[model samples]
Target: MAGKTHDFLMVSKSILPEAILKTAKVKELLAQGEVYTIHEAVELVGLSRSAYYKYKDGVFPFYEASRERIITISLLLENKAGVLSHVLNFIASVKGNVLTINQGIPLQGVANVSISIETAGMADTPENLLAGLGEISGVRKIEVIGQT
Candidate 1:
């Protein structure tokens, strides 16, 4: 059979601004060393270079209120030297600024620790942070004992 077909298709989908949808692309470029300069990242993201520069410091996903509430988190960790440090690291990773730490002597292979965190500048909500802490290995228990 000798036949030829030519068809034109119309695709109607609205495309929004790439920068507004996926801001991480620009960040990934910087992280992976794919883009060395802001000029390059802005062009890659199809956003105005000036806009990228102006909003880089302020555009964040998690919005936290500057309330006077300081969250007190209690963690039951395995009796290991690094376990407590690891929990602290996790808190820092989530941008939870540590205010104070109190740890009881290890008893029965576990240590009870209380950490007061200032999460005003953190991106993740306090609940999400607690959930992440609960997932940490060697953490037997995690509880938000106080929040105000």
Candidate 2:
């Protein structure tokens, strides 16, 4: 880190929408090893580095914005049979189109999973989507880590 630092926010820094906040979060996660590196990070967010960097510190997308969004959800789950299946069923029940799902091998009864989904045709709003997922058994933590 050097030079006169600049925040990457593109949209006004008022009440940020959900998408930008979600994307910035991805950047943070990548930095913190919560997620991985650049290519994965941008892909996870469905944003070009240009767009992501543009709003990395500023704009955000919301549940309302999620209607047009393709976002990735990261989960920390208990390593148990039917856990991932149940999660997928919940996502499908809400009409979330599964884009990609990546899961690391279980370690110490826990597995970290990253799933990307398109919200365009979802029957429920993103907030409701999250709530539904939260209710499922074995799903410990969920975060909309990226969106565009």
Candidate 3:
């Protein structure tokens, strides 16, 4: 599944067109049990059934985008104590399940670290997780290396 992950972009709803926005709302209504069927959800949101189907698979809230996904992130960190520990703690704090971690030997005051995490139970989106990690001390660089 390493090469099968779809790329995603985070967009502001305020900048989206109405049909797309309505399609997302229809999905929310159905997912939250506010509506019984797709037909009902679409109707509640003033979206046509055809439009709902068109966008349903493509549009979702940020929290749902990474749901059930496994993502690999690569980081460059300073050769300092507790940097890796802090990274792991941050992942756990957001309920990200760390599946594997590979750390390279430090050279010239920096180390390359790759972490694969299961995001099914994470409380935040992958984008947010990356942003949070970038804020921690000793983090020199962060980027998503892969996903599935």
Give a tens-digit lDDT track for model 1, residues 35-77. 9987788787787876666555544332122233587878899
Structure candidate 1, residue pairs in collision: 69-148
lDDT of 2 by residue, 47-113 (tens): 6677677766543335645676788999999999999999999999888999999999999999999
Give the local distance difference test score of model 3. Answer: 0.89
Q: In terms of TM-score, how similar is model 1 to the real structure?
A: 0.54
Query: Best by lDDT, which number?
Result: 3
| C-alpha lDDT of residue 71 in model 3 | 88
lDDT tens string, model 3, 1-148? 6779667876788899999999888878887899899888877778888887788789988657667989889999999999999999999999999999999999999999999999997888888999999999999999777767
Residue 46 of model 3: what lDDT? 81
Candidate 3: pairs in clash: none
Assess candidate 2 and give its lDDT: 0.80
TM-score: model 2 vs. ground truth: 0.60
lDDT-best of 2 and 3: 3
Per-prediction TM-score = 0.54, 0.60, 0.64
The superposed Cα distance between candidate 2 and the true structure at residue 112, in angstroms, equals 0.3
